[model samples]
Target: MDDGSGIAPPHIEGYEILEELGQGGMAEVYLAEQKGFGRTVALKVVRLSKYTQVDQKELCLRFEREAKIVGKFHHPNIVTVYDVGTMGNFLYMSMELLKGGELTTKIKSGRVSALEACNIVRSMCEALSAVHAKKLIHRDIKPHNILFRDDATPVLTDFGIARSVMNSGDATGLEDIPDLTEVSMIIGSKRYMSPEQSIAAPLDYRSDIFSLGVVFQEMLTGERPVNFHDPASVSNPSNNTVAWPQEALIFKPLVTKMVEMNKENRYQSIDDVIEAMDTLDNKFVNESAPLRISRIYLFIPLLFLISVAIWILSPFTTNYELTALDPNNRLIDKSSLSIYLVEGLEKIRSFKSLPVGEHKIALKVSGYRTKVIAIDFPLERNTTINLTPVSSPSVEEFYTFQDLLEKGPANSASAKEFTERYGGSVLSDLVDIWSGENAVLLNELSVAAKLNDPSAQLALSELYDRGWYVPKNSDLAQNLSKAAAEQGYAFAQFQYALILMSQMKYTKDEEEFIRLLEQAAEQDFFLAELLLGMIYANREYRSYDPEQAHRYLRRAANKGDRVALYELAQMIEEENPEEAKIYRERAIRLGFKVNQDF
Candidate 1:
């Protein structure tokens, strides 16, 4: 059925293919010799024979998308994208050749020094900062994706599943796949997938941080924390086991949080990860001063005098005025907070005396998240620390979670993903109500809505519309819907647009209402698409286009909306009676009852 020998072409775009390096699912890597400079390069190519004509075009578009993304990045630690084009039948890309090979090889040989590993991780943080600043997520970040040069500098590569956060581009040819549901499926190296990514959850920069944690863990222990790479194992938090030697104890906490089951619980950004790294190692720094020999001697005498003075005056003088801050920067009461002198030290809320030097302190509050912060005495600087509420998720996090639920991962398989990630939260009861797992109390639902949960927002909005929970207020419903919509929740957008459309007699912004409806439709909201198509069938709100209406109705029908199918049948009845009859029959099968009355 297959030939054993490789079909290595002689040359591509004047670059001679010297030898086969290896093969992957989508493409093959080759050691190539460039014609002009005679420089060696790694050329990745997708052979034409491996795919059909239609598939070749689709795969090439995907390959080109990867090229377009990586082309924008220029960093010493990032693989350099040379030229991207097609030669004969193969879509290929030339990248800077690395002679040292993959990071996986070095990791397998032996454990790297902790300092070396931290430095490598710092480089990754810097690279991720660049990527995130560009509003992109490197969905595939693993030891295998990291390559090394002669100098042992790590270079990040393979942008096959990287997604742009801007959401401002044409499809990555993924829609052209025969089974479109596969698009929502996990698309990365399983061993290094973030928990959010494991469930097909929408990702941000934090996802890359999680993946980097897996790689960093392996770098120190010579194996992954969770070795069996599968959708289930990767998603399960209990499977993660830190096998750290005594030397790596200092880094255990940071690594453990990096691979947190919840994105909100993880370090919020690349800067946060860098901060944790510097916290784990005093040697990692961004603050320093030049000390000459003369200054060193002068400073020693000055320190002796200051220490003598501090010894005598320290009893009466204040060492530092420490103030705890909530995540919002509001001054938290000292009574509710417990401040520890150092890591693993006893907790003390109020301190009478402290040393006149750098100190590390951990802040733990009853209902707030805990963190260790490095502080300097006599430092009254307004440095901020993030605090996550123990009882309820914040407005931003609540809305982000809603965005994840609405569009993050929605396939049937994703639905069966371990629920404990979201189920263990304080709002677990509220979530259970939404999933029909359990009922939530009315007061609890109201509290969740007030705390910014999107489902609670929708429920409260509906109640407001019918005078159920609190009061009947259409205006309040409109506001709640708009708030959720702005957070990129498709359901809220659709509801907000509908509420406004019905209240057009009381409201005047027809254009805004149409725009809101279209935004929801763009997200492939079936109901929104159907309503938009119906609205566009007439010039009731704005200039109407029959063609546009047909296009949207078609999209809704593709998603198996019976109302859209029935409407489409009506629209084509005069032009194509036979097709209309078939559409009508299908709509009826889907329980669409035809009615003459509006």
Candidate 2:
């Protein structure tokens, strides 16, 4: 059956292709009827010929592993993967098909109502929470990947680039899946990428949360929260950027925390985000509830009597004023304080008056721990309580250190103070690495590597390979990387593989070199996968195998790699002009310059 794209759908057993639903970088989704089940499903098909091949075995294994990982997810908010199989050079996955349309369509229409946006985000949190529980990082969480059921319940789909977080104890089946890492071959849209994801850094559940925050903001304001011209500014977006309708004001604080550029500052867990959203939902409901005007006369009399009684007892009632103090007993800003009275479950103003009695209340301040204190009115009418600051340094301190560090080693003393304050922390370690002397840094890394720490071994490997703060030593780099690689580090394996190739030992130890590459590729290391494809496709390498070349190239091309696309197109130009034209067009669209009249 022809999918409207003019390409005939691969005939898979037990399913009849109806029409194409959509197509992404690697897969084309079609609406199909499942036999026996007598139900419609989305059949996502990835044609092997579409991407240039690198290694046939590795490509097939990666595809099957991805399917198995996603198929295990069984959440209502997550799209269901029913079955997966290969048919005639095509890998097809049967999944639940939703007709309500993509979240992108809803976002394009205009800003969604506050309630609807909250509900959608709540669903996403639940879905993502489940994925995180399984130790998987979605990597991609944008409106385009979010669909809805007929009832408008948001469902997350597309785990194409999602992978398990490192050091996962429960990520059983996901251990073997290859995750895309190279910046050039990074899959998914860049607009919604988290700050860390943009640089192809290690990711966790918080990465997905940042992307979700971007989508949530877009859904509310009809624009992304990020400043496209200065994406780094997303960490602290000003309230004035988007004119949030008065009704959506409740979402401002929650959304602000979601898109924090520093993952450490973002919501630590999906449950926390969900809880915050629930609070917003309750506040929104209470604020939006219409005032009833019935029984005006009776209500007016009752209100008058209460006002008269309160006025009579004005002298007797003690005015309760709260002052939140910092560690030094200095008063904090009133705007930073959120006071809640335990009695009557009321949220009171910071300086509001209260009745003369012992009252319990909770106080929350930005960058400080929440404190609950009980105070008796009339005895201590005005109270001051010291709020212990959180142990971690605030974002402002980080900025201060960054500015000082930029002044070079001359200002290293000032930067060292900042690092000392957060001693033994990750931030401090990073600062020490950057602000300290290169000789000291190299010595420290060497000591750690000597202790057989894989992380240190990997770091030393890169430093030695590039001659950073040390003389260039390819042999030492290879040995260090191989040490880390032997301990089952995927990135280290990739590095060692490249180092092996650079040493030109592949001519004598071709088997071992290819083994390293496959080991790394099997872990979904993008560069290793790309390298294998390139090596097999080129006659310069003894590993040249046409079938392997095509498989690896196809996988890389499907990942939006322009080089892969251009090369794959050239390889198949004579035999498969039609497919080659499609590949070439894709390359051109990606801004790959080609000579006219090929």
Best by lDDT: 2
Task: Write one digit per residue (lDDT tens) for candidate 1, span 1-598.
Answer: 1121244453586798888898888788999977744668999987777687888777877777777777766454678776788776677899889887887887888998766787678778867877787777888899888887765667788877777653534333333322211435787877788866777766678889889998888888877766434657656757666678766666778887887767889999988897677565552211111222224555567766566345334533234455667657888875455465543243332232344456666665544534456666544334456554433332223333443355433332333332344443333333333344232345444544433345456656765665543558876776566655654556677777877777676335667677887887777777678888888787764648899999988888887777788899999899999998888898778656566211
Residue 544, candidate 2: alpha-carbon lDDT: 81
Error of 1 at 128 (Å): 1.2
Tell how far residue 433 is off in model 2, in angstroms: 71
Top-scoring candidate (TM-score): 2
Please provide TM-scores, in order, for all candidate models, with all chains considered together.
Answer: 0.45, 0.48
Instruction: Give the residue spans of candidate 1 off by over 4 A.
Output: 1-5, 166-183, 226-241, 283-598
Candidate 2 lDDT tens digits, 374-452: 7765456577888764332333443344455457646777768867786533245445665564565555456445434
> Looking at model 1, which ten-residue stretch has the lowest summed lDDT?
283-292
Clashes of 2: 15
Whole-structure CA lDDT of model 1: 0.66
